[model samples]
Target: MTTVGNRSITLEDFYQILFKDNAIEISPAAQKRVSDCFAFLLDFAKEKLIYGINTGFGPMAQYRIDEHEQAQLQYNLIRSHCAGQGKPIDTVYVKALMVARLNTFLRGKSGVHPDVVALLTAFINRDIFPVIFEHGSVGASGDLVQLAHLALGLIGEGKMWHEGRQVPASEVLAAHNLTPLSVHLREGLALMNGTSVMTGIGVVNLIHSRNLLNWSLVSSSLLSEIVESYDDHYSAELNEAKHHPGQQQVAAQMRAILQDSDLVRKRHEHLYDKKVTADVLEDKVQEFYSIRCVPQILGPVYDTIASATTVVMHEINSVSDNPIIDKDKGSVYHGGNFHGDYVSLEMDKLKIAITKLSMLAERQLNFLLNNKLNNKLPPFVNLGRLGFNLGMQGAQFVATSTVAENQTFSFPMYVHSIPNNNDNQDIVSMGTNSAQITSKVIENTYQVLAVQLLTTIQAVDYLGFEDRLSSVSREVYQQLRALVPVFTEDGIMTEKILKIKEFIQAEHVQLPASVVGQPAAVAATELVAS
Candidate 1:
């Protein structure tokens, strides 16, 4: 179980709530703080013209609202802003948005009534998710359109995802014996004025990116074994001399994965006096850059993922709304804390890193498929009659095409701002678009990595030395083989490829605890601080 708003929330905590069926509770202290803040706001708004309270919002802020219509003002804000137009976002992301927004309110700085927080908590705990759309946010002024849809759901005015189906919010709330939220004072503005959309998507993206990174390392190790590559490239002395912690960690992980493999050649075995076979003598002294530079290439990726995780985690735990009420000082400060620049920049960096990782995996897949580069493996790793089978020839093209798609999405969304909101939000973050692209990139990467895994297994089988595989590699190979059969006959492969992608995405395979540790968990902490 997890307690929302009582303390800082981590990515892991959010994942637990979403995937682990963990229940959530709002603490008494948080409720009291929220009540106190709302009381202060009510008293403060009676005399002074407060933004989103007695006064209008955005470009119309100069106009004052009649006191009798304050509640209607809040209601109109939610109704007018329900402008999202794309397909409904996945329920999990909407839930994440709710949790993130709830956390912000729990900070007791948004002047939201405690009932608002309670409704959000109930939504999460009951698995009732709002029907938020994908294309409504510019990531400035707090994802207003998308969040307005969320606010609409809270008021039993929009659609919701209930029991795996879309239903009217009024019907769902009625069935659950819950009452629609009554917006009071600044509650509507507080609900819509934040970065929950980007933060929620970023949290999910960060987790998927981490899983991809781990699987990339595993795939690299398996490729090295398949090619009978030399172990000198991952030597501890070489990585230690570079003094890069990420590089060293990659080297360590590679060493751990390739530890007991007989296929990886030791340096001493290449000595002139060893009396090796002629084929052994002809082996390249070094490998292609994709195989030789795993540490250097993927080291920065690891660090970037760690850094992005830190930024996203901090965003999840922060109070990112405007007009922060400092009850202690008895003052309200309106600022642009809702700007999603932090998450936008980090997501851009993460997408580029993931793209590079996919590029490397594609190259490795080529090395395993092409006869000229794959040593003794047959062309396309085909095992059928020489002229009859195409094998994985077409699959490699798909992997390359996916990699190209990833490159296209890798462009930074944060740098392309356009004016909206009557130019009040002249410079926007486009964080929701950035994070959505990052999510697609991650999906594409999973497919690319799936291709590599499938090719590696085929190559290993062609070599007929499965007995020599490292223990972990053999275990993973067996697990995959259980799902996908060897493609000796050359038929349609779309289903097979998708199954592997799903398997990876579902995290059915995991590295042993020894290969990943506390170092990986905290790698970005220091980087984030700097």
Candidate 2:
């Protein structure tokens, strides 16, 4: 079981909990911290006026609540903001949201009752996810609307997903012999006012984006090999001259992926060692930019994803809540620590990087499909009668259309913030919206990559060079060939595209640590089965 609260959660820790199904346990030290913070808030609020405890929230902070109605105020904040409108967020993202929320409370600063973290832990371990919506967070005063839905679940007032079915929160909590959280000393305010919703979704997006980059690298390597391209483009000598770590690392990975391949030709042997006999050489001197400039095209994408991972991980460990209760200092500090601008900007940048990666994948797919460009494979890589049968032609439309959608979705959501909440949040983050859109772009790229991979295997079959490929390329080709055999005549490829997409997403490709310039876990990871 993964332990929360005792220490900050790492990306690896998140991967274990979300993908490996490791249950969570609250550290005893964390439990004590929560109890202490709550005890301090109780004593401190007796004769003093705290923001949410004694006064109103947002613009209504001017109104003071009666002593008897303090508890009701917390409940009112949660239920009133359960105004999220849209389809429910996927359960995977909701699970991430729960973990992010639980971690914040575990920091012992939210002044929340111990029962809040305990209940969240129980829900996470039992696979019980609150029905959070896709919309309803401007992300300045935190993911208020989205997290209010989370708070509603904790209080056992709304719907939740359990055992693959949406059910009432009360029923699920009861079935597991678990009780819902009871408000104590600002529990509702603490739960509803945080950036966990955006942070959680951003974390998931980072993981998938990293996976997509690795697959794109793999696809590029295979494409280069299939066409007997020169090895110098990915060589250390060529990439090192550029002086970017991502570029150098990508070149190293390409070299590793195409190791021991008979298909890639040595530059000197083809040109320097031989005398020119024919005035016009039949073999093109250089390949298209899509095939030759893989490292240059994808280098920035690698750096962007790495940078995003840092920002999102920091956000995960941060306490993005209002009125931090410092038990040691015996003070409750109020400020806007809940702002999601950090995550919002990172998600926007990440989607832009991914959009470029999809464009690269599309260009490579086009090179393979158009025989005139490749001069190696038949039109559409069709092995059957050229005009009568369509091989991967229909699939190209899917890739092209998906890439176009990704381009449209790449528009930055960070800059699209609208003023809400009585102008109190004049400059909002729109962080949740950014993360959700990034997730879509990542998913769309996977569809594009799937079509490209299918087309690639078909092209390799046409060349009959299955045995001459690098070990890694050979393994991938064999696996994809097994999924859908090389089709000669026209056939329905919709299911084949999906099968390959899911297969590659679930499959983990671990490049050498020395080559990737990072640990195996960071360089590439398996997508958790969704």
Q: Which candidate tops lDDT?
A: 2
For candidate 2, the 10 contiguous residues with the lowest summed lDDT are: 521-530
Candidate 1 structure quality by residue, lDDT tens digits, 375-482: 689988888877799888889999999999999999999999999878899999999889989999998999999988988888878888689988878877888898
Model 1 spans with C-alpha error above 4 angstroms:
272-281, 507-509, 517-530
Off by over 4 Å in 2: 507-530
- Report backbone clashes per prediction: 1, 0
Q: Estimate the TM-score of every prediction.
A: 0.95, 0.96
Report the alpha-carbon TM-score of model 2 versus the true structure. Answer: 0.96
404-432, model 2: which lDDT tens digit per residue? 99999999999998997898898999999
lDDT of each: 0.85, 0.87
Cα distance off (Å), candidate 1, residue 124 = 0.9
The collision pairs in model 1 are: 142-194
